[model samples]
Target chain A: MLSIQNLHVQVEEKEILKGINLEVKPGELHVIMGRNGTGKSTLANVLAGRDKYTVPQGNITFNNESLLDKTPEDRACSGLFLSFQYPVAIPGVNNMYFLKAAVNAIRKSRGQDEMDAIDFLAMVREKLKEVALDESFIHRPVNDGFSGGEKKRNEILQMITLEPQLSILDETDSGLDIDALKIVAQGVNDYRSPERSFILITHYQRILNYMQPDFVHVLMNGKLVKSGTMELANELEEKGYSWIEKELTAAD
Target chain B: MENEIIKKSIAEEYKYGFETKVAQDTFPPGLDEGVIRALSDIKGEPEWLLEWRLKAYHHWLNMKEPTWAKVHYPPIDYQSISYYSAPKKKTLNSLDEVDPEILDTYNKLGIPLDEQKMLAGVAVDAVFDSVSVATTFKDTLKKAGVIFCSFSEAVKDHPELVQKYLGSVVPYTDNFYATLNSAVFSDGSFVYIPKGVRCPMELSTYFRINAANTGQFERTLIVADEGSHVSYLEGCTAPMRDENQLHAAVVELVALGNAEIKYSTVQNWYPGDKEGKGGIYNFVTKRGACRGDKSKISWTQVETGSAITWKYPSCILQGNDSVGEFYSVALTNNFQQADTGTKMIHLGKNTKSTIISKGISAGKGQQTYRGEVKIMKSAENSRNFSQCDSILIGDECGAHTFPYIDVRNSTAQMEHEATTSNIGEDQLFYCNQRGISTEDAVSLIVNGFCKEVFKELPMEFAVEAQKLMEVSLEGAVG
Candidate 1:
C-alpha cells in the first residue's frame, strides 16, 4: 500500500532522511525504532507532506500513485493519516466539529454523502469509547488544557474515527499511563485488518509488547540500518541504538 | 439563471450599494450657522434645542480634525457637503408608505422592511441616508414603558430626557468627530428604558448611506434608568462608489444604578477594492457612562468592511462597583484600514473592567488595536484585565497594538496581554493532513483566535460573525 525509494530529505540544508527505502503491504504492521534525533520523526513528517522537510531526491508512491506531488490534504483524502508527535491545541474549535469537518472532507472526496450533525456525533461517540475518551471531551476545544494522557488518547480517537488506509503513529505511547497506553493499543489493534496498514514509530518497545508488529526496523543516522521480526525490538531494547550505530560505522 | 448570476455578481461586487431615488430636500453644499439653522428649522425644533444646535456648531468650528488615530485620509471637504437632506414631502406613517426606492435599498442590504421576515418579537428602526424611514414595534415598546423613536422626535416629545442625557457621557467638545456629529447630525434612534424595566426584545438600528456626495452624521443616545437593562445593536452599510464618503457618527449610552447596557455594532461599509479607489471612511465616537452604584456597560463589534475605520467605543465607570467590558473583532481586507479598541475610566470605588480585542489583517489590509485603561484617585481597589491578539494572513499586511494604562490609585489591579503572529506553516500543515483545505484551515485558526470575542455575541450574530470572518479573509492565502 505504501512505498518509498531512496527518500532523501533535508531541513535547512542539513540532511535528515538519507536514502530511506521501505514498503508496507496491505494488513502489515511495521515498527520503526530509533533514538532521539535519529530521523524517526523526520521520516513521519516527510510522509505526511510537512513543508519544513525539503525532499532533495527520491520518490514515494501510495496505491501506485505518485504521493510526493500531492498536497497533504490530498494525501489524507487518498487514505493517509499521521498521528502527530505533539497534537496542536486549537482554542475555540470544538474537537467534534474538527472531526466532522475532516470526515466530511474525506468522504466528499470519495463521492459519499456528508453525515449530518446528529449522525456524526453518534459515529464519533462509538469511536471515543474505543480510546476510553469521555463524551464531554467532544464539546471542549481541541486539546486546549488537555492533559498529556488525554492528548495522546485524543489522537488515537481521531485515528479510529478517520480509519485511514495507511496510519502512521508517531510517539503515540509517549506520556501515556499504562492504562491509557493499553487503550490506545487496543484502538490500534481493533483497526488492524487485511485491507489496512500501519507504521508505528517510537523509541520504546513497551507499546510493542501490547500490540506485536510483523516487522521491526532500526533507524540510525537518517538511514534504516536493520530489519527483522518483532524479536529485534526486544534485542534493541536490551542493547540500545549505540550497538546499531557501531554496526553501521563498522559496515561503512 | 442569467439574471440570477448577474444579481449575485452585483451583490458580491457592492454588498451595500443600493440607492433610494426619492426627491430629497437638500441644502446647498456648505457648513455654516445658516446650515445648522436650516436643519433645526426643518425638524421644527423647539427654541432650546435650536439654541443647543447653534452652541454645538460654534464649538465645532474651533476644533480640529483628530490626527491621533492611525487612519490617514485626505482632509474632508466639509464646506462642499450638505448638512441636511431628507425625503421631500414624505410623512412616513407606516412601513407600507415608505418610498419604494428606499425600501428596495433596505431589501438589497438584507434588511427586510417587512415585519414578517424579521426576528420574532424583535424590533427594528431602519434609517436610510439621514432620516429614520420606519420604526417597527414602537407601540409595543411604548406599552412596556419604553420610549423608542427617532432622536428628532424625542427632542420634540421628550425634551427633558433627551436634554438630560444627550451629551452627558460624550459632551460637545469631547473630540473632533463628536463635536462635528453633535453639530450637524441629522437623525438616529433614541431609546429610553424606564426604571426597573427590562427591555422585552432586542433593539436594532440599521444605518445605510445612499445619496451621492453626501456625508452621514447621525447621533444615538440610549439611557437605561435605575435597575433597568437594554441591549442595543447598530449596523451600517454603504453603496459602492469610487469616491470615499465621510461618515462621522456619535453614540452615547447612560446606565444608572444597578442598570446594564450592552451595545454591539456590525459595520459592513463598502470596503474599497484591491487598489483602494473608493469606500467609506467610518469615523465614530461611542461611549457609555455607568452613572450610579453597581451599573455596568459592555461594547462588542465586528468590523469587516471599510476603507478606513477609526472608532473606539468606551465606558466611564463612575458608580461604585460598576463594571465595564469591551469585546471586539476587527477584520480588514483588500486595502482596508482599521484602528479600533476601547477606553475604560474607573472613577468610583471597586469598579472593574475587561477588554478583549482581536484584529485580523489579510490581503494587504492594515489593522491596529489602540486602547486605554485609566483608574482615578477615587477608584479604590479598582481592577482591570485586557487581552489583545492579532493574526496576519499575508506578509504584505500589518498588525499593530498600542495600549495605554494609567492608574492613579495605588490599590488598582490592572493586567494587559497582547500577541501578534502570522499563521504558522506547521499549523497549516497539520490541518492539511486532516483533509481540510488551506482556506478552511486559515478560517479555523482565525476563528479560534477570535473565539474569545465571538462567543460574547448573541447566538445568531455569533454565527453571522464567523461567516463574515471567512468572507473577509478570502483570497488571503497563497
Candidate 2:
C-alpha cells in the first residue's frame, strides 16, 4: 500500500536520510529501530509531509499516487496519520471538539456525511476505553497539563479515532509506563486489519514484546544497515546494535 | 506554502461593500452654528433641544481631539465633512410607505423591515445615513407600555423622559467625539421600559452609512425605570469608499432602582483595504449608569471592522448593591487599529463589576486593551474582577494592554489577570496534520481564544460573531 524508494532527505543543508528504501503491502506492520539522531524520526516526519524536511531525491507513493506534492492536510485526509512524540497543547480547544472537527473534515473530503454528534461522542467514548483514559479526558483541553504518559495515551486515542489507512507512531512508547505501553500496544493491535498498514518508529523492543511485527529494520547514521524478522529484535535486545556495526565494519 | 494561502485569503474583498441608488437631500460640506441650526430646523426640533445642540457645538469647538490612543491617522478636517444626508422620501407612516429602494437595501442586508417576515422576537429600527426610516413592532411595544421609537420622534412624543435622561449618563462635555456627536447627531433609536415592566421582544437598530463625504453621528439613549428590564442590540455597516469617513456616536443608558439593562453591539463598519487607504474612523463614546439601589447594567460588544476604532463603553455603579459587567471581543485585520475597553467605577457599598476583554490581531493590525477599575471611599465592600487576553496571528501584528486600578477603601477587593500569546507554527502544523486547512485552523484557534467573551453575547449574536471572526481572520495565519 506504501512505497519509499531511494529516499534522500535533508533539513537546513544537512542530510538526514541517505539513500534509503522500504516497501510494505496491506495489513503489514513494520518496525524501524534506531539510536538517537539516527534519522528514525526524520523518516517518519518526511513520510507525513513535514515541510521542514526537504526530499532531495526519491519518491514516495501511497495507493500508487505521488505524495510529494500533497499538503500535510491533504495527506491526512487521504488516510495517513502520524502520532506525534510530543503532542501539542492547544489551550482552549477541548479534545472532543478537536477530534470531531478532524473527523468531519476528513469525512467531508472523502464525500461522506458528517458524523452525527451523538454517534461521534459515543464512538469517542468507546475509543477512550481502549486507551484507558477516563471520560474527563475528553472534556479537558487537548494535551494541556497532561502527564507524560497521559499525553502518550492521548496520541493513541487520536490514532484509533482517526482510523487511518497507514499509521506512523514516532516513539509513542518512550515516556509511557509499562501499563500504559501495554494499553497502547493493545489499542494498536486491535486497530490492525487487512486493509490497514502500520509503521512504528521506536528505539526499544519492549513495545514489540506485546505486539508482533512482520518486518524489523535497523537504521544507523542516515542509512538502514540491517533488515530481518522479529528474532532480530530479540537478538538486538540481548547484544545491542554494536553487534550489527561490528558486522558492517568487518564486511567493509 | 501556507503564507500563499494567507495572502490569497486576505485578497478577498469585504462582503457588505455595495452602495444603494436613491435620491438624497444632503447638506453642504461644512460645520458651523448655521449648519447646526439648519440641521436642527430640518429635524423640527423644539427650542430647548436646539439650545442644547448649540451648547454642545460651542463646547466641541473649544475641545481638541485626544491623541493618546495607540493609533495614527491624518489630521481630520471637520469642515470638509457634510453633517447630514437623508433619503429624499421622508415621513413614513408605515412600512408600506417607505421607499422600495430603501426596503431593498435592508433586504439585501438580511434585515427585513416588514414585521411579518422579520426574524421572530426581534423588533428592528432600520436607520439609514441620517434618519431612522422605520421602526417595526411599535404598536406591539406600545401595547406593552414600552417606548421604542426614533430619537427625533421621542423628542416630539415623550419629551419629559428624553429631557430627564439625555446627558444623564454621559454628559456632552465628557469627551471630544461625544461632544461632536451631540452637536449634530442625526437619528438613532430611543427605548424606555416602564416601572416593573419587562419588554416582550428584543429591540435592535441597524445603522448604515451610504452617502459619500458625509459623517454619521447617531445618538442612542435607553432608560429602564424602577424594577423594569430591557435588552437592546445595535449593528452597523458602511459601503466601501476610497476616502475615510468619520463616524462619531454617543450611547447612554440608565437603570433605576431594581432595573436591569443589557446592551449589545456588533460593529462591522467598513475597514480599510489591505494597503490602509480608506475606511471608517469610528470614534464612539458609550456609557451606562446604575442610578438606584440594586440596579444592573451590562455591555457586550463584538467589534470586527473599521480602519481605526477608539471607543470605551464604561459603567458607573452609583447605587448600593448595584452591578456592572463588560464583555468584549475586538478583532483587527489588514492594517486596522483599535483601542477599546471599559471603565468600572464603584461608589456604593457592596457594588460589584466584572470585565472580560479579548483582543485578536492579525495581518499588521494593532490592538490595545485599556481599562480602569476604581473604588471610592464610599464603597465599603465593593469588588471587581478583570481579565484581558490577546492572541496574535502573524509576526507583523501587535497587542497591548494597559490596566489601571485605584482603591480608596481598604475593604474593597480587586482581581486582575492578563495574558498575550501568539499563534505558533507548531500549533498550525499540528492542526494541519489533523486534516484541517490552515484557514480553518486559524479560525478554530481564535474562536477558542475568545470563547469566554463570546458566551456573554445573545444566542443569535454569538453565532454571527463566530462567523464574523472567521471572515476577519481569513488571512491571519502566516
Candidate 3:
C-alpha cells in the first residue's frame, strides 16, 4: 500500500532521514521502533506531507501515486492519515463540527454526497463507543483541556470514523494507561480489513504485546538495520536497543 | 511567497459598496448655531429643544476633537461636511405610500424590514441618512403603552417625554463628538416603554448612509419605566465613497426601578478599500443609566467595519443592586482602525458589571480595547469582571488592550483578564491535514476564539457576524 525509496528528509538544513527505504503491502501492519533522535518521527512526518520537512532525495508512492507533489490536504483526501504525538487544542471549534468538516471534505474530493448533521452525529456516536469516548465529547472543544488519554482516544475515534486506507499512528500508545492501551488496540483490531494498512511508530515495546505487527523494523541513526517478525520484538524487548546499536557500530 | 499569500487572503472586496441613487435634500456645508437652528426648524422641533441644541453647539465649539485614542487618521474638517442630508420624499402615512426605489434598496441589503412589515410584530424604525423614513407597527406599539416612533415625531407629539429623557444618560457636553451630534443630530429612533409593561415585540432600527459627503449625526433615546422591559437593536451600513464621511451619533437608555433594557448593535459601516482610501469616521457615544433600584442594562455590539471607529457604549449603575453588561466583538481587516470598548460606573451599593470584549485584527487593521470600570466609595460590595481577548491573523496587524480600573470601596471586587496571540502554524497544519482548506481553518479557529462574544448577539446578527468575520479574514493566511 505504501513505498519509500532512499528517502533523505531534512529539517532546518540538517538531514534527519538519511537514505531510508521501506515497503508495506495492503493489510500489513509495520512497526518502526527507534530511540530518541533516530528519525522515527521524521519518517512519519515526511510521509504525511508536513511542509516543514524538505526532501532532497527520495520518492514516496502511496497506492501507486507519487506523494511528493501533493499538499497536506490533498494527501489527506487520498486516504493518508497521520495521528500526531500531541494534538493542538482548537478551543472554539466543536469536536463534532471539525469532524464533519473533515469528513465532508474528503467525501467531496471522492465524488460523494455530503453527510447531514443528523446522520453524521448518529454515525459518530457509534464510533465513539468503539474507542470508549463519551458522547458528550462531541460538544467539547477539540482536545481543549482534554487529558492525554482522552486526546489519544479521540484520535482513535477519528481513525475509526474516517476509515482511511492507510493510517500512521505516531506514538499513539505513549500516553495511554494499561486499560486504555487495551481499548485502543481493540479499536485498531476492529478496524483492520484487507484494504487498510497501518504503520505504528513507537519507542516502547509494551504496546506491541496488545497489538501484533506483521513486520518489526529497528530504526537506528536514520536507517532501518533490522527487520523481522513478532519474535524479533520480544528479543529486542528483553535486550533493549543498546545491543542493536552496538552491533551496528561493530558492523560499521 | 508567504507574504504574498497573506496579502491575497486579506484583499477581499467590499460587497455592499454600491451607491443608492436618490435626490438628496442636503444642507449647505458648514457648522454653527445658525445651521443648528435651521436643522431644528426643518424638523419643526420645539423652542426649548432648539435652545438645548444651541447650548450643545456652543459647548462643541469650545471643545477640541480628541486625539488620544491609539489610532491615527487624517484630521476631519467640520466646516467642509454637510451636517444634514436626507432623501427627498413626501411623508408616508402607511407602508403602501413608501417609495418603491427606497424599498428595493432595503430589500437588496437583505434587511428584514420589508419582511417584518409584511408579517408579524417586529417594530422597525428605518432611518435613512438625515430622516426617519418609515416606522412599522406603530399602532400595535401604541396600544401596549409603548411609544415607538421617529425622534422628530416624538419631539412633535410627545414633547414632554422627549424633553425628559433626551440626553439624560449621555449629556450633550459628555464628549467632543457627542456634543456635535447633539447639536446637529437630524433623526433617529425614540422608544419609551411605560411602567409595568413589557414591550410586545423587539424594537429594531436600521441606519443607512445613502447620501455622499453628508455627515450622519443621529440621536437615539429609549426610556424603560419602572417594572418595564424592552430589547432594542440597531444596525448601520453605508455606500462606498471616495471622501471620508463622518458619523457622530449619541444613544441614551434609561431604565427605571426593576426595568431591564437590552440594546444590541451590528455596525457594518463602509470600511475603505484595500489601501484605506475612504470610509466613515465613526465616532459614537452611547450610554445607559440604571436609574431606579434593581434596574439592569446590557449593551451588545458587533463592530465589523469603518475606516476608523471610535466608540465606547457604556453603562452607569446608579441604582442599588443594578446590573450592567457589555459584550462586544470588534473585527477590523485591511487597513481599518478601531479603538472601542465600554465603561461601567458603579455608584450604588451591591452593583455589578461584566465586560467581555473580543478584538480581531487581520491584514493591516489595528484594534484596541479601551475599557474602564469604576466603583465609587458608596458602591460597597460591588463586583466587576472584565475579560479582553485579541487575535491577530497576519504579521502586520496590531491589537492593544487598555483597561483602567478604579475601586474606592475596599469591599468591591474586580477581576480583569486579557490575552493576545497569533494563529498558530501547528493549528493550521492540523486542520489542513484533515482535508480542510487554510482559509476555512483560519475561520474555524477565529470563530472558536470569538464564541464568547458571538453568543451574546441576536440569532440573525450572530450569523451575520460570523459570516462577516469569514469575509474579513478570507485568504489572510497561507
lDDT of 1 by residue, B1-478 (tens): 1122112221125445656677987888889988888888888888887787778889888888888878778888898877777777574577878878777777776675678787656677887778888888877898999988888888888999998888888888888888888888999999999999999988889998878778899999999999999988778888788988888999999999999999888888889776788999999999999999999999999999889999999999999999999999999877789999999999999999999999998766888899999999999999999999898776667898999999899999989898888776767777889999987888998998888888888776788789877876766674
**Model 1 bad stretches (over 4 Å):** A242-252, B1-14, B18-23, B89-91
State how far residue B338 of model 3 sits from its true place (Å).
1.1
Q: Please, what are the lDDT tens digits per residue for candidate 3 over residues B1-478?
A: 3456676664677777877787778998998888988999988888999999999999988999998998898788899999888778765577666677777777777765664545545678888888888888888787998999889998988999989889888888999999999899999989999999999988999889988779999999999999999999888889888889999999999999999999999898999888889988999999999999999999999888899999999999999999999999898888899999999999999999999999988888999999999999999999999999998887889999999998899999999999998888788888888888888898999898889888887777789889988887766776
How well does candidate 1 score on lDDT at residue B357? 95
Between prediction 1 and prediction 3, the one with superior lDDT is: 3
Query: Residue B253 error for model 1, in Å?
Result: 1.0
lDDT-based ranking, best first?
2, 3, 1
Question: Which stretch of 10 consecutive residues in model 2 chain B shows the poorest summed lDDT?
Answer: B3-12
Per-prediction interface RMSD? 5.8, 1.2, 1.4
Across B1-478, the per-residue lDDT of candidate 2 in tens digits comes to 4455456545337888999998999998999999999999998999988999899999998999999999999999999999999999885579987889989988887786788896667899988998999999989999999999999999989999999989888898989999999899998889999999999988999999999999999999999999999999888988999999999999999999999999999999999888888999999999999999999999999999899999999989999999999999999998899999999999989999999999998888999999999999999999999999998876678999999999999999999999998887778888888998878888888888888888887888899889989887766664
* Candidate 2 segments exceeding 4 Å error: B1-9
Q: Show the lowest summed lDDT stretch of 10 residues, model 1 chain A.
A: A240-249
The CAPRI class of candidate 1 is: acceptable
- Native A-B contacts reproduced, model 3: 0.80
- Clashing residue pairs found in predicted model 3: A92-B448, B9-B475
For candidate 2, the docking band is: medium
Judged by DockQ cut-offs, the docking class of candidate 3 is: medium
Q: For each candidate, what TM-score against the reference?
A: 0.94, 0.97, 0.98
